[model samples]
Target chain A: MASEAENANQAPDEESIISDFFVPLARDWPGAYGLADDCATIAVAPGHELVIKTDPIRAGVHFFSDDSPADIAWKALAVNVSDLASKAARPVAYTLAISFPEQPSRSWLGDFTAGLSEAQEHFGCGLIGGDTDHATGPMSLAITVLGEVPIGKMVRRVTPSVGDRIFVSGTLGDAALGLRIRANMVDGKKPEQMTDHESLLVDRYLRPKPYLELRSALRAYATAAMDLSDGLGKDLGRMCRASGTGAAVYEPDIPLSDAFMAVAPESLEERRSLISSGDDYEVLCTVRADNVANFVALAASGGVVVTEIGIVRTEPGVTIIDKAGEAQDWAGRGYDHFS
Target chain B: MASEAENANQAPDEESIISDFFVPLARDWPGAYGLADDCATIAVAPGHELVIKTDPIRAGVHFFSDDSPADIAWKALAVNVSDLASKAARPVAYTLAISFPEQPSRSWLGDFTAGLSEAQEHFGCGLIGGDTDHATGPMSLAITVLGEVPIGKMVRRVTPSVGDRIFVSGTLGDAALGLRIRANMVDGKKPEQMTDHESLLVDRYLRPKPYLELRSALRAYATAAMDLSDGLGKDLGRMCRASGTGAAVYEPDIPLSDAFMAVAPESLEERRSLISSGDDYEVLCTVRADNVANFVALAASGGVVVTEIGIVRTEPGVTIIDKAGEAQDWAGRGYDHFS
Candidate 1:
């Protein structure tokens, strides 16, 4: 996909932008045709099935319009690949379609592509070809991730059985708290004036660590699985609804990072709001009671902590139990784009 | 993917929109996980390599902001699948990422998805999964098409040899002309006052037919190929650049439909302008000089008309020769996003 003209400093056009910036990002994938051909080709590894997912983000909606370009690029790719991780699939490649408000400066593109390259290397995937175009509206990105899983072994999101143990990876609420901080809507103290632990919460909102390393254990032990994008409460509710089942989660047992705890709301209603807020980007699953110990051990080996939070039930809705042994009411079910 | 609540008369939310509208479109693909899971899994057909391409279109850019929903849907899918067609690949599946400025009316979604469904059937590909979100900007679509070709057999864009016969499928300039008509930039007459042939050109601009029927012959006989999206002159220039060769296109031999002949500007300059305007969506290719007869015969059997418009040359740039045996200067190549 390279051209002699690409090295020269010139006004960017569609072709030159692709050859100069995108071509290097595609260098490792021989099938990418170096982003030159009409399409890219890849042979699925034998004994595997391809797992695919597409996710999109927009300025002012998913992230602030003025957010760092690098963080924007990372989140765009991370969210799509995170879906693959939740399916117990290992990343292989990705295609991105990006629309720009205007022609971004070369430095903006450089930082953006650098972030993309880093994420690709970190996730062990290569960049395939994608489409780039101008937009008279807000900048947006749509990424499609391609991954592989052992044949017939992808974990399902609708197979949790009654009495199965419900578990989640890492912690939640940090991202939600971070959002409040970014909007300057926190109850007290501004982001810059906050403590280190509070600042960590903001970072959590900007960059989520998808639990890819624990994918194997999840596939081997979980009865059902899904990524926690729409917060644990709503997403877990979705999994329950899909399986024609329900879940009883102990409110106090829901994991929260130290950073989230430092700035978190104390009132039961506010705590519930934070708990049901979106963008955790962690795994939520059910394991047979007998396999819970093994699953935890296996995940720990990969440096991901899995905490048992509740149990699946035959009842048909999600119920959260307070420390006082009473059901608590929440206003909304995480973030719903249309709602 | 369907839910009982979906049929209720209520304001749409993320889940309801998906259940009522997107689910039915996904029902045929078991691997789509009923659009319930975070990821979808598909085993590649044995011995086939996956050919992937992603293309996004936006309101006001790729189409009029007020274009019909069905046509927009068709164009979104068709453009991506057209890339597959250029690669001589047979499509298997696709994923879509859509962003909306506001929640669309059910009727809009109905027509949009209906158009998508029809395109899927027409292309023989299934909708696997997709992501939907709200945008504070214009409605936009990004589609990733996955097609298949026999292992290592996908056609390329950079193998045209010197002295190769350059052929182009179907007519050029109709889509470009259609754009002008739609924009009221047409000379002398309004669209409704135009003849059927002129209206036909407008239709061509709106709905491009990818030359899929000629794919087999293209792979078998053509030295190199690419779909003409950015007009013949510019795209041909790209192909030559990719192959490190040049081209000599005979102006008189360039294919033009009867519709174009009626409204086309007579001056060489204006004609060249029409030829270089974007959105032809035909195929431009170079066949070995020896394969010309057989290639034309095979394409005819497929009901595709290909004309020998030019020849490849050892020189390294495109030369459009006029009827008077002189090189004509043209300003600008086809569309470039940044430019």
Candidate 2:
């Protein structure tokens, strides 16, 4: 559900989402930013303080309605960890508010628990507590993760510096292509060609790594960082808005896995949509150009890859350049919550 | 629907909620204690930790399905605050997770937000951050409150000293009366009658006043304290179970309003039920008898009225005595989420 919601929420409906949801949240959570911005500014830990982020994913809307319960669980925890990963904070703990239907089978619950346990081990986040109730509606999951970074070290979407080199960890469109395979849109594909690659993409889409290791290093090395829950185009645009700057990325430089290129060679339009499709769950960051080599090396030592895809600019809007350095129209970048 | 759910959740056939609708949540929230506890413990501030409590108030379950949106909002925030109050923690911040059908009239949301704003101001708590999504089913309001207490000051239901005097703040059973009135069971009641004698009781039922004053006071003055949420009978039972002690409350001394007695004279059965009916939101505390007088004077100075209803016995379990100290029986006690 998260993979799907991670996409659906990015569609051009964030206006409604903001009006209906964020407006009320702003009204209720009156702080420095309110709901007008990405994260709420809260006073915590006396001198250090903290930043909080929350998002919800619904079944059918967020993931394939028939996604494995284990995968569902992984995505649920990973997505929230992803939120913390963006802030360059070490996740301290999290709370979940779950709504389930009556008489959920023990098996259903066990699979979900197993998935959560696996992620908890991987992420090192302690689940402090949350709510469980009987719901007669759709399956919905909302997890709120709390993390701590040094007060001054916390990286917000607003901190990117103009002329900063932008970077992303992991491949880009394989997850989006995975959905295409599941939908039977990729014909003439040998099962062997996709056996490992497609499955890897599918799994990544279902449970992309949260990039926790990258957070601390990013804060020290990168000027601003955010998790690519949405595709690069839309998410990068958001980064620009936060930093009050513009950006220019070469399309050919965007990271793409062999599996992704093989699956969607002829679908340039589809490829374009994938760039805005969301649910990537990798970290997209902007670092000073001088620090790019070290940034790449830090992730490399951890067996994770970081690629420089673009550069933040002092201009006030986003631009995408082709291989020939011709600016491409990037009208469609990421998903929005409301239409 | 919430009222129906409140009564019917324990019936084991509730999962019909999801199979009946197609919905989902994003799949990545980190956790070990995500789904199994009544509350989640979080390490918020270093020396001062926090207890996070989130409860969803569905129409028909937590409140009458016909309740006004304003009252519903009030009850939702009030209930979560009450949980912290039980632990004797100062209210700090809260996050609300709300899901309602799309296209809800702006006016409905306005009233709801107004109610929530009112509660926030009254409690000195700020809304931190949370989520809002669209749901096609019943209106569900999930509020998560984060409260900080000094490490040693945060009392749990599981800690009570033997020979401690059990005290309760304000009165009990009035919330139960409001439930009855809303159910149309208690009639011929006038608006003025509910003002003076029953005003405290009726208001206590609808808009429960948290014992925030009592919480800080208890840190220095109490051995163990908890809010009487479920009811006097059941809540006392829990305290006894948690503390590994016994308690005996004299029934004739149970606090009540003169109007409550005048309006429902034959409601002996009702009164007895209120003892166990839950949702009173008053404090049930245990203190060594030696310090009771000083605590009482402190409570009085804070404008909070507290009454001693029982004594913590060295034995295990609870026993209710009448005016003459004879044993008493109740049909049942309080609202249990699972039971």
Candidate 3:
């Protein structure tokens, strides 16, 4: 797989990376070098406790077979740490268990480590401990990230109230559009596919950003929040379910960007399509309607994108309004693990 | 699958389990909810911290396909925690991911959860997180356990000196022999199948107790140590490799239960075979000769078996002598993960 990449004849396989990358995790880590053991030990200290989360990336399921190893590593940690951000947690440590196809090339490992290094650097997360091995076939990358949150302030999903207004950070649907581009689709993706926006969207697919910078503000302002994965429509469905309230989202109110406008244009059909497409790693949140203006203003001061998209209602179902003021039809959209 | 399981059945439909069993992980683990994001929140705690470990259990590789689900769960945690015990760490929590075939039986899942609950209760370990999904085929279980240890006290497989006495806790070969029993070869496992002494041998196989009680003392007294997952021959070879030492064993001095006499009274070959079989799950430590007698007596008082199997030597090779002073030849006898 490493040999086949079109560019970068250099792959991730290097002895230096093996030695330099993970040594300190064992040297300075609380319970490093705990071989043949259940867990490496962490000695809790004042003002810091363990933050932990796990997510699985499976071969041929989460990524294309041809995707670079670096991307795989990035997504593995990014997805897990993104959860930390929602709780306003500061990531401190992470461990990885990667099972690869037997005799995998060393460059693949090198690229994977580079991705991990990049993400860790971005988040100030240290590589604490991990394990690796060869499996019969298929690759499964499982990561557990440990972070830190201030005492008594970690966010929860069940905090949205009936009168809360729904807000979203960043643009949605780009990742799903990127998926279309990867599959060689032209018309289905937003109009921007004809231009350089294609690259931006595709990058979103390959490397969804972890919004570590937004954690503190989220803890301060948003009553409830989650990253928009599995599509805005489906994931919003999850949040509403958790908070026990219904929602009414106005399509025209959703915040769109120049990148999105250049791609989506102002078509009613195109706007409807964005609701159900998955893989946008933006934050969807709820706040009292009275705070929407201040929330947007505060987020803008921080240089983050926040748009009021909807409101929580007394009823218990997600309702979407089209640009033409008609109710939009819903379908079985979004990725379901079984379906 | 649910039909045969009984009154308390997990949803038989694969879709329901995907949504119900795995999804509830977010609800059950408040630390990981991260406000309904892709990952969970983690942080370092005051006076304590995070430790990480990952271990794999493959079908037909680690356990038989026909083993009950409950037993499989117990074995999975047992093997992983056995490593923690060797390090004298207190298990804090764990995350589990299962890559399983489609259409597993309902009885299997119920049993699997039962086993997990049983082991968790026994070890005082709570499962904080996990992922479950369908693999292409075959069953694979990977569990990552986290434990707590005091700063600077966790043990490792290093630091043994040339003169350290090599020690092993608990009996060997019984679990290996137990495998033989599971395979319908009752040659030496069952007590009634042989004599009274041999029955005790069978007990060792069914549930090989890990030396959790000895963890603290070893952390204080031992130079280097490892769990005897494989046989003494190979596991000791590993300890020597890590510590850069050789060993000399007085063959007749190796502890042998009278079970050997009952199972194979006249067969020296059978005795050797029993010794070499793996899955002992005992702790193998390299202790200074000065501490040898004291260590043995200390562990014995705790109602656990501890024996001096050999001595670390300045010579750069392993040497074994029989009762008659004749050199005894043995191959690398232990479990090899890969052929």
Candidate 4:
């Protein structure tokens, strides 16, 4: 492969990109070795356990192939950090494996690295080590994020009890609605006709902010918790299944931004489908009734909104109640990668 | 995408595959949560530091698209473990991100997981977490391996001194020759005419054995070390560049398997080219001359052959010497992912 490519004489090799751009991003981390060595070494603090997650995003699958390289890089890192936050862990480092469809442009790489620098600083982590390669296909970004949590204190996805109040941080379904706008499939108006508030939904889809600030409150008050990437309905179903319980969620109480209500589907059926669409990246947890006030207060202090939408129950499946307190059949079950 | 696919009525969902097949592989690890949770938690030993490396291999680039799924899986794990071995670290866990070109068959998945089970047990590590996705492109397996070394003791790729004796483990060039056979590009004889010994070379190419047993000896006797994956000449050049030293390697002293000699190219020039063709996962290290005998003895006790191939020098580039004690110009550098 190298000989054939050399015969054609391509100008910069993978190594040069690592040295010129990626290495600068890694300079602050002593273990990164300026991207020279095969691996990086890191030590966890004495009282903490490492929380690890790997999530891969492909060009056409996770984001549009034409999305800005800077936004692409940010989404790649933020999604993995979202997993760490769900576990009530603080982000520390990440290893990125990126394969480009072709030799990336200098401008694109520059913007991408700039985005990565901003994210690493914002989340208090550094690039530890990674691998880069050339692909004859779409670009793929697979990130393995490492985080730290106090030993034996990380929250879990199971252990929710009957009567535990279900709460979610931040409004839901904006990303899903934003995805519709990006796909140009929004029902009524085209994206060019979108209002400023509607564009906020598009930004939410492009750049998800993992709720890291809610970690402390979740660890202190929640029994079962997870991130809302797979939509509130589907993800909550998973949490209930794991905890051996079910939930009764009020459809009118499912949080939505004013912008979402203004332009998104309005009828109960359409609204339920929109809200159940995923990529929220917010914390979804079940807290004991006694701890609800304290959890709400802590979340507010952290500058995050918390809303009670449901309560855990001994029933075997999720039940959605309309404004009239009548049960409605769900039209969708959230996003499944393969169907 | 999910709705369209669902309306089209695909055979299975991604979640079912995870719950049915992948969860079994992760059953023994409490941190894996039966592959249910979004993240895994692990506590490193107090005095140990984590060593991490991520390498991604694509179907056509790293292996043939038609290669046995089991062999592909083994190669995926072994290659990453080889990186850890080069750093003198003990393998502990790994996160896998696999993108499939199409939904794989049950038999294929079963064979692949069986190979993973074997490799994980052989290396004393467990699956922590990972991501799986469907791709419209070629299959890509990106793995991030986590290893442990005593704090402050992880081996690095630099710091070799003048007068250090360079050593390599196992025979070289067999895998490179095997690749040619696999590609049906062998100069004289077709692959169908290959002998059992020659076939062993192909197996070596398909599944590499990471030299983990030599970790203790390497930590004790070597000043600097790295794996010889991108051909000996190119990789040695990298090591020299990093350590600010040069090396004079004797061509005749470099070890080669009988299988490679039987079917590989003849003449000094042909042999040099063959030896320089990459994918030799053997360790290449520079040790103090005084410790050569002890290092060889330690390696022998561990049932590994260590060969003295060169010596580090004060000059700045690698010099390849023939049996006549004359330097020869290398026609090819190592494999570059992007040229």
Candidate 5:
């Protein structure tokens, strides 16, 4: 899209920005036309369909404005890729629409595009086409990712049956804890962190590594799936509502990382609150009883940890079993932007 | 994407927003799963490829922040559709990622979704999936459109031959003039009451109707094509440079609308400047000398008025021939956001 007003003369021209920064990221994709054309083309295999997702993040809204540009770029792509991974799709290409409040220095763009290059290589996708513009607000990026999945094979969030066992990948609440740690640092409530666990937690908050390797296993055995974005409690409630069922999650079974254990509050209430704080990009899935062993084994073979944390039920809302063996309602407890 | 912070309590929740305002937009697309799934799936026809473009617009940057929400929604989708139309592709679906600085009123969202509904009907496409967030900046929308064209048949912006005749759809400067009118109104230079011509110009600025009916003619006849968002001089220069050719555009042959002529300044220089000022959203294309007659006839049959404005040249730059028949360099004169 074209901006209505000409920007300050200090910024680099659009042509140079594309040629010097974005063009290299697009070199691997022939269909990108070297970013010289208005649109990009993608060819889907005969029996495959395209899975599409668009997610955008803004500075100060999603991340601090002073955060590293490379981390910002990676998070923007990673979030969208995480959705594709949960759908059991293999990413093919992506388009990036970026808005800058002012002209960024060459070093910032260099680190940003370098981050994009690294992400594309890691995820096995390439840049196709995009739009860049000057904004009257904070810097924002919207990335639309295209992935391929066999027809009728995508793991949907609305397909879980009453007897399905719920599982989650990796650990939960690490990013949430990481975010809190950063908030304390910004508030001067803590000294410059010295703990390795604190650093690990902050890294988790900065860059989420989407588990693309588990796509095959999920597609083969999961009855329903979605990425844990809005916290497991609320997102699982959404899935259950869509599937016309409910779930029972065991608090003791909810996986927590070593870093989270080392740095988080000791109170069970606070721990539970952090668990539902969202930003966990891990895949949340449900498998039939008969396929649980196979799904677990396959995911394990791919070096992805799968922890059974819950079970689908005939009830209409999600319940979390406390360590004391009492069932407590936990539906709608995840992060809500408008709440 | 999940927002990291909770917004003020005054706004409607995200769940209600999606179900009330957006779910209807996805009703026709089964792969959208009623907007309940994490991602949407698209199936391409056997002999076709997907043509994708992502263009985003922001309040205060692309349009006035107080612009009608309906008009804002329409322009966001129309600009992207215009690009696909220039590629001779049929828009199939689109994903919209929107950020609002605060929770918008129900009435505002109602009008916005209605506008999206109207646009989808107008363009023969459906909304698939998207993300909504509360921003700390101006409201912005990033729309990614997916269109389809026969394999290897998408019009290229890099294929114009030396002898090809250049053509452009519709008029040249109505939108540019309209934008000027809007700026004057904002600046209190224009009266509150607008002439019908001025009103028409403003409408052109607000909502661009993509010339999609001419896609068949373009796919069959045009050697190269691109949408004129950055004005004829600069965009044509881009096509020429990419195709390794030059162009000579005749000033007398440039088309203008009755509304533009009635309200625009009478000076030849100012008229030429407006013609080069960007935001036309029209198609600029090239046809082989032998195909010009057929292309014109077919475009005319489709109710599209395509004017022959120039011819491709063996020289190395775009030159505008004045009414007095003197060639003047007019390259790189279009809107550059960073300029």
Candidate 6:
């Protein structure tokens, strides 16, 4: 055990941090070896394969430095869970690798691990293994999630047929608008006080609740699927290009939350901006025209509302129809980290 | 496809980077979907379980920022592969998530991916999936490796018996000395010129070759095993504590490379320092007294040299016996990131 004298001039060492805080998250998984082993083992059921996804978030780039440690932990895991959901897989385990610029306070670590515990419980997964190190830059987290599905059953993002109907889970644009509102507040351009609707938008940005309930519907009916991380316009373009197809989306059908509508104006530019922004974390998928009714009904039964926003076309690009019925190409219009 | 015009103002966007540099690494794995899908699936053979490990490295912390990108890539994957080897598992696939402070140049990315290609081929694994994002901090790479072992056959780190003989594969302390040499060079405390032995030590620090050939031997005969990343003295203490046992290591029996001996003085303090530094990446295990001969023969047949360094004890701490036969406790004497 690590004593206070051993770390008199610093925070707890790596061994102490893992033993004191992270070990509880691994208690439910026998193969984790209580985080004592170098590697963790998972037994895959017969006739099933493991689905894997990794998405890392960095401080200031993915979340604000001032955000609650619990929220940061939740967001890190939720984004990876969102990807697994898009693949129609059930998450079973995850590994978190964190790098800290400085030694974190014990209180901060307590809150962070508490948040991780809550996240693992909510996602129905266990923490199997991870690594912690000191960094000379901002803190960052890279989470790799492991899910399972029957052999050859994971939904593919490149199998959408030309005439399939394109659908999206949950309301779009709330997270993006929430990000904008937060940015305004950070810049001191907006009032310090926010309305409840504005707070909802900010909440959407901070904590994206992935639509894991839609996994069954997607696996059963969707022909192709992917999570909407880079906004509908850009991500849809990627799906269409990969499938050798195109899409024609109706602008007026884009779903918006009550909070988004309550805060933002109803201008065409606003709609386009929302569609082009990133961080939705919703599932974007294509279903066979014949299976649309069944897919919608199954998703609704699971308490998830999926909206048909467009139809895949034979052409090779994405077209967004304006309220005036004018079709405009909207390909490659989303957040680009390098741009 | 992303065009030049789309990235005229900055580095190529994430899509172009994935398509141009990363997709080729995933071509060998069918489930990778050419890096087009959000997640990848891996089918485990019947009666086998998946072993997983993740270890991330940060620039300026784990490696110098001026180091070659290819070496950086190799070290990132090799470290995680070392963990899987310790569990007696055969690596199959891996996911890489990299966050860059700024968009890397095209040439830098080319070398980085080429290095990954070389490592995957050498390690008998394939790239499955990954994520790339911009960071406001230093560059970091988090690699998660997936391996396979027969059900209930994984060599654990917490099952060493009190009477087992502790062994380690390969020579120790070369990498630690190499790191010190590099640090001295960076600080201008040493001359720019280096001897051949010094260069060899530096090479060990830059790229560690894990003792993967010992996997079969360990699975067949070892009672407990783990990779030695945090020096023998500290890692052995962890193993002992986890298994409710202790260890008595012979200082004279500790293996040292010719390069390390030629450069490092033959002093007790130097030996202790070498045994307390991190980043060895060698396999450490304990074999039953009855199986020691067979284990040694099996490891030798695979061209790996196993050194009998100690014996597991009934007590609860690690002791290193000096030339004078005086036993000194060295339980918590390894590198700690926060300290």
Report the C-alpha lDDT of model 4 over B25-107, residue by residue, as the tens digit.
67777877777788988888879999999988898788887777888888898899998998899998888889988887666
Fnat of every candidate, listed in order: 0.90, 0.18, 0.47, 0.83, 0.91, 0.93
> How high is the CA lDDT of each candidate model?
0.85, 0.66, 0.67, 0.85, 0.90, 0.88
Error of 3 at A336 (Å): 1.9
Error of 3 at A115 (Å): 2.6
Alpha carbon deviation, residue B16, candidate 6 (Å): 2.3
TM-score of each: 0.94, 0.79, 0.83, 0.94, 0.95, 0.95
RMSD from true fold, candidate 4: 4.7
| CAPRI category for model 4 | medium
Interface RMSD of 5: 1.0
| Candidate 6's TM-score | 0.95
DockQ each:
0.79, 0.11, 0.40, 0.72, 0.75, 0.80
Ten consecutive residues with minimal summed lDDT in candidate 2 chain A?
A31-40
Clashes of each: 0, 51, 38, 0, 0, 0
lDDT of 6 by residue, B1-339 (tens): 656555444466688889998999999999899999999999998899999999998887778777778889989999999998888999999999998888887778887888888888888999999988887677889999999999999999989998999999998888989888888788654434888888888878888888778888999999999998888888999899987899999888888888888888778687678767878989999999999999999999999999998999898889988778998766468877777
Best by DockQ: 6
Q: Write the per-residue lDDT of candidate 2 for residues A1-339, one digit (tens) a residue.
A: 546335432422223333332233224222212222111223355555444555567775567646777788788878878877766777655656666655344455556666776786788765555555556677777777667666556665656888899888888877776766755523545446567767777777778787787765777687777788767877787678655788888788888888777656577667877766888888888889888888888777767788888889988677888788788776346655433
Give lDDT tens digits, candidate 3, residues B69-113.
Answer: 777788888887877777677776777878776655555666677
> Which sections of candidate 1 miss by over 4 Å?
A1-11, A185-194, B1-11, B185-194
Badly placed stretches (over 4 Å) of model 2 are A1-51, A64-66, A179-194, A322-333, B1-47, B64-68, B183-205, B262-265, B323-326
Q: What residue runs in model 5 are displaced by over 4 Å at the alpha carbon?
A: A1-11, A187-193, A329-331, B1-10, B186-192
Give the residue spans of candidate 3 off by over 4 A. Answer: A1-39, A185-195, A255-277, A290-298, A329-332, B1-50, B103-105, B180-208, B249-278, B314-338
**What are the per-residue Cα lDDT tens digits for candidate 2 across B245-311?**
8888878777775656754547666678865787788888888889999989888887888898888
Model 5 chain A lowest lDDT segment of ten:
A1-10
Question: Interface Cα RMSD per model, in Å?
Answer: 1.0, 12.0, 4.0, 1.0, 1.0, 1.0
Output the lDDT of residue A78, model 1: 89
